[model samples]
Target: MGEVKAIKGADWKLEIGGLTELMGEKEGPALLFDRIQDYPPGFRILTNVFRTQKRAALSLRLDPNLSGIDLLNGWRMKLRTFKPVPVSVVEGGPLFENSMSDGEIDLERFPAPIWHEMDGGRYLGTGCCVITRDPESGRVNVGTYRCMIQGKNKVSVKVNKGKGGRIAMEKYHQAGQPCPVAISLGQEPSLFLASMSPLSPEINEYEYAGWLQGAPFPVVPGPLTGLPLPATAEIVLEGEIPPLESKDLPKEGPFGEWYGYFADTTVGEVPLMVVKKVYYRNDPIILGVPPLKPPNHYVSVPLGAAALWDQLEQAGIPDVKGVWGFVYSAQTGPFTVIAIRQRYAGHSKQALLVASGARAGAYGGKFMVVVDDDVDITNPYDVIWAMSTRCNVREGVDLVKGVWTSPAEPAIPPASRSPRGYTMDRVLIDACRPYQWLDEFPQVNVFPKEYKRDLEKKWKL
Candidate 1:
């Protein structure tokens, strides 16, 4: 955000769709107006924090031009050795420059933007991280979940089933207890990155943030919840998620998701957190990151790609070259691509099965394509070309059903949907040449080096 600001950031006009509604639909890096209207000026809004891979890399202190696999691989390597530095408590940082506690909690007074036109309500936790604790292990969990304001001190939240935050909350439900939680906004980018990362269960995201920035992720305890929070955060809301019956739960969405579509207005009745305490800097900034569509994968793709690639390698899938959950699907769903140098008859299939069956690919996965090393998984055109010529639909396609997916899948039969989970069909396209034809595959058409050089000199085309 500072980098973009230094370059005199561009203005993004708000119209019928609302201030942040059209942000996800844009294609390139344009750090636009975060706080446009329906809010005060002292409180700012930081939008498009991770809209492009270039900005993402620069925000993480990587080369400004670093992108795709290079950017992802660099972070993946650092993630392997995340020795999390314990959060240190201090008087407080910028986060506690002001205060709102006890009966002072006021949701409407905050500059929370109503992003999309079709959203159920104003969302406050779009770019924030929710902190909770495991009932059994007491391990701290930080997750990014959609939070919608209900009343003055109330907000509803829904988390994906397989998420660590959900798991922690479920543990509380099992014990018949309310879960304590803290949601932080306008915090350090490293903290947000770690919260969104697909890290191993054993690794805490705080440590992951430390590894990302080569320093500890400074934090202080929430006054009400005692959960750690980014010390320099712009605002903090501490509350408890009380386990409630269906009739007592709160409705959360109808908001635009990362997939650019609104499948279900509400995931289900979710627990509402009653804010008991609030802390903020003098003129707080609300970190707004509303999910809209494709270009939004600046967060999902690079990290998701590297995490899936690492998992495949750990599973002993040899000859693997690259993997990506294309931005077209927000890094989830059927568009996952894996590039491999097929070494044997069924080597490619083995890679396919592991990738499809793994937790990462288990949800919203529709089409998983296995391409040869010569094809670039990052390039959709390259992947499509390989699919066109190297694969025969009848012989190369493999179908796998009963694969787990989010209930938000629009194509799922409504009768088959359940609050527990849902299943999506998956197809593997073996976009590689026939392994039997070892020596006789047709060579790709290309100009010879001298001919290309001469053509380059003679024509600007």
Candidate 2:
């Protein structure tokens, strides 16, 4: 934002908004805005924090100059060997300077923005991470979910039924125990990345972030909630979620979702968090990352690719070259591509089935393409061409019915949806050239590499 201001000055808003419309208009940069309106000055808000692959490179401690697929591939490569560092819990930090308790735990003191005009309400926890622990296993979990400001000292958090955080809290609820929770408003960027990631239960984000940053992710136990809180966080809301059965629960969003749709749901009751304590520093900044259309997913997309790649490789799927999760047009695009070298009659289908059904391609992908190794799956154009030229729709296309999917997918016919949650009809397109006659397939035209290399060397091109 500072760099943008230095260049655009008075016209920064137009530049920022235009550039953030998609992941990359031209050499996309990760953007963070303190605030668009002056309603709440100095209560810093973060938007499009990791809007592009180039901007996301910084999380891997890589050069910011790297852009596009190179940046995505770089992070995925590093994550293959990435090891998380354990967190060192400290006693306290700036988060404790101004404490709120008793009757002062109001949500209205800070300036929360109505980010987009169509938003349902002012959201406080857009970029905030919710922390919870399993009552039985004591395993900790942190995740990013929508929080709508409902009343003073009260907010509603969307608890997706299958989400790890929800599962952890549900364990407490089923055991008739109050779930201890904390919302860290702003912390290190790496921490936010981890919270947005789908990490296994044994791997806490603190350690994962520590490895990404090449240092320990410092944390402290909250005084009230006792769950780990970022030591240098701008603000921390320590609270508890009381177990509620379907009667008279809190109402959350008609808000815009990351899928570029307003989430109007039938189940009006989602989990509510009653703020018990509020801790903050002087002039603290709240990282506000709401569900913008074509949502910025720096950590989710690339990391998810790496995880999926590893899954396919470990499953003995042969000659898998790469994977890329398209994050545009969806919160972690339901579109994914896999590059593989066919080895047998059913090899391509096997790769597709293993990946689409695996954890990496969860939430029922809308369109998954299995491209031949020649296709650069990272490039959208190349993937499209492969789909058009290489695929024989009647012969190559297939569907997997009754798969778990997000409730927000527009493709699911209205009559099929109900209170039981969503099931998807996933489409898989074998975009690879038919392997049966590889020897007879036409080859692609290209300039000779050595000729171009020699010319460039002499001309300094």
Candidate 3:
């Protein structure tokens, strides 16, 4: 509902993704593409929907005026008040306007964009939620996983190991049954945000989305799979992932990842699903959220860091002023910074160590920096300045080996990677002034904000 720039005649090949990447780099408005090359006018694609804080705040139902760390802090506070608001089930809704089943299911009818030039194929679901229920617990999980269209009614879902959906799918496969799944290709913003959050396994994303919007999320059961589908979703697919041996799994990825690299593709590692049904509203829109290079994140703010902030407090780290991350998504990434009011001699280091191992901060992390409260962790220049001025490399830096990481880590040699797990090293930097010499530490050289304001007012020159 924010700034939308509607355009026409963009090819689904590189044109659409190229424009989306270009607009994101410019920090422009959300793009709505219509009259795509070789497609009818009604099949649309929306991209760059969260390129600004104001837009992200609106989607999260928070104060739109907030920005930077204040916006993230507002979300952190809102998360503290979270209580499950169950979804509302309805008999039917707009999502059923068009339906196809079995032989009639043709995924190519929709506009799936080849987001990156070297991407293995056209990704049908990026800003999409893949819904799967745990076979044992029976608790449903909604998560965002890249889905690449492979055939008329087939797509490869890259649900990584240890993810909720992957774990649930494995459970069903082990029991010798195909894992039932329903994917919403485009839905309400709140649901999309919830799907992308780093929630605990016990938390249901639908209930979380309801809480985010301050009302019940409306859903309709998928006629084929019985999974709850967003009543107002633009497009929905009901399918099942069958048990496939390593040799049977399909190749997936080589798509650009959040870390700004086209990681190697799997030969036969990603799960492939056969779509049993397809449903869509008239004039359906696909939410395309292709990953761009660093600094141009999928979301404007480092939202995942909010979860880490809470994790630090839960771990009993005192005086944490704020937390921020660069190249971050779902709370894990390459660089993270924690601002704190150093309380003891080892306070900064303790914060660093705990954060480097905490569930919310450990995964896929590379550089962990801790700074005094005076340093603004959200600003790269400020954080780097603190590290340069305050850190004594020999005394302030520490490296932890074989830490938790993701498969997308470009630095991990392919030969070293194994199906069992992946690990990477972490560099922790204490940017806070030496606590023992607090009384004698050199003060920062900068003009006070109030002093500068008063000077500007007096010198109306």
lDDT of 2 by residue, 1-461 (tens): 33221111211223333444443333254444543443344554545556555456665678778765566667667777878798988888878889999598778677665544555666777778899988878888888887777788878887676778888988888889878899888888888878877677789888888888888988889888789899899988898988877665755556666666776454456787889999998778777565555434423345667667778888999998888866532222578898998889889889888877776676646677899887878788999999988898998999987777776676677788665567776688999888898788888787777989999999999
Which residue pairs in model 2 clash with each other? none
C-alpha TM-scores of all predictions: 0.90, 0.89, 0.98
lDDT of 2 at 62: 81
Q: List the candidate 1 regions with Cα displacement exceeding 4 Å.
A: 1-38, 296-301, 328-332, 448-461
Candidate 2 RMSD computed on C-alpha atoms after optimal superposition onto the true structure? 3.4
Clashing pairs in 3: none
Clashes of 1: 4
Residue 450, model 2: lDDT of: 94
**Highest lDDT model number:** 3
Query: Candidate 1 residues 156-217, lDDT tens each?
Result: 87776777998999899888898999998778888888787666688888877776777777
The CA lDDT of each predicted structure is 0.74, 0.72, 0.91
Sorted on TM-score, best first, the list reads: 3, 1, 2
Assess candidate 2 and give its lDDT.
0.72
Please count the clashing residue pairs in each candidate, in the order shown: 4, 0, 0
